[model samples]
Target: MDEVEVVVAHSERATLRVGDMFLKVDADQARIDAEVAAMALAPVPTPEVLWRKPHVLAMAALPGTTVGRLGGPSTGSPGAWAAAGAAIRKLHDAPLPPWPGPGRRPDELRRELDEECEALVTNGVLPADLVTRNRQVAEAALRPWTPAFTHGDLQIAHVFVEDDEVTGIIDWSEAGRGDALYDLATFTLGHEEHLDDVIAGYGTDVDLAVIQAWWALRSLLVVRWLIEHGFDPFTAGCEVDVLRSRM
Candidate 1:
């Protein structure tokens, strides 16, 4: 039997790799549905959906290593970053999916931001003033946006590259219609130093302020979740470091 490697296992979800197959197990059925739907709609390369059960999704593994990791220098060439940028552009321009769910709704997101900010400050997980500043910066991203196909969680690890070209992107559970810049922001967060390389390939005008705002907003909101999931956000170079850089 092929050894089953635990990719990541948390209370809400887990991923395991067995030989050539990657299996995702999540208690949330809707998320699995959204991932399947979005991958079917996206124009960019994505893992091939093999089969799915109520709590499990299986996909054919793609070739190539990940583009990079957060809080670490990317070994990928600038051109690969550009290629990823170009892929994002293509996805954003493609036809919208038949149905985009309640995506980053203004009211809901505001409530979430407020709650998460309060939690961070109250828990002493982050300095109150730092949370306050980032929350304020997050105001820029709270405004309405023309929805576009977004990889909802476009972290660097989700993008795969081979020979300076994007071979595939994984983790579509967060994929949906939302702010295009949000995807860019999430993809570039913790690695702001590479913004220029990405933009050079994106070849389109983007609001830097909004992107920066998202970096702060997303970091602030996800810190608590990371803590609960057995991940550390305050380690030397992690989400907390990303937040501190903004200060």
Candidate 2:
């Protein structure tokens, strides 16, 4: 057997290059990759796709890795962040067909919260009361709004940066119609100082308070997930602190 070149590895999936083709796999996660590939190529004006073999193989590898060197000091430059913000704006502005299905409603999100709470309890990571409280706060905060197509897991790690510019955005499995500000909030929550630059780049007059609320809610959810999955809590806690400072 030959060793495949590993492109990226996450808790959910591992991307590897086998000969001329690329393969992505996880425990029963191939279906998700197929769905994401379909959505990404659905006249969305995103990165060009080369080829795909059902849910198992998808080819298109850009040169360069995510920003910030491994085990090194934070190299997330402000200029790079500004460029990424602009890239996000372009992505959001792209015309996407109305998402199918019932879409994300507040009631549905509340049910998801309940499910997350149960998962956290089963993992014994945090007090059940904490999860419930966080969910209640998030639900109440998100209730007064409509949803839109958003990159559900927008973060620095998902952005491919080279020479202070974003070459591409990888990982679309979490993309769906939810809230317009969801991605922005997720990106800017930890790096609050970059919010000004991102907002300026995005050139939107949306309510800052609402954006801040989203940031808080998203941070709480991220923390809950991290704890449940036994991941590091430091990063999520830092984001939560940033949101708290703004509040």
Q: Top TM-score: which candidate number?
A: 1
Tens digit per residue, CA lDDT, model 2, 126-230:
566655555554554556555555666676566666777776665566665556677787776556666777777676766666666666566555656555565
Report the C-alpha lDDT of model 1 over 1-247, residue by residue, as the tens digit. Answer: 3599876678987878777877989999888888888888888998899999999999987788766788667888888989989999998888877777547687889999999999888888999989988888888998899999788888887888999889888778877778999999999988787788888888898999999899988999999999988998887657898788878
Model 1, CA-based lDDT: 0.86
Q: Which portions of model 2 miss their true places by more than 4 Å?
A: 1-11, 16-23, 26-50, 65-74, 101-103, 114-141, 144-147, 235-247
Query: How big is the positional error of residue 136 in model 1, measured in Å on the Cα after superposition?
Result: 1.8
C-alpha local distance difference test of each model: 0.86, 0.59
TM agreement with the true structure for every prediction: 0.94, 0.69
- Model 2 weakest lDDT span, ten residues long: 65-74
Report the number of the highest-lDDT candidate: 1
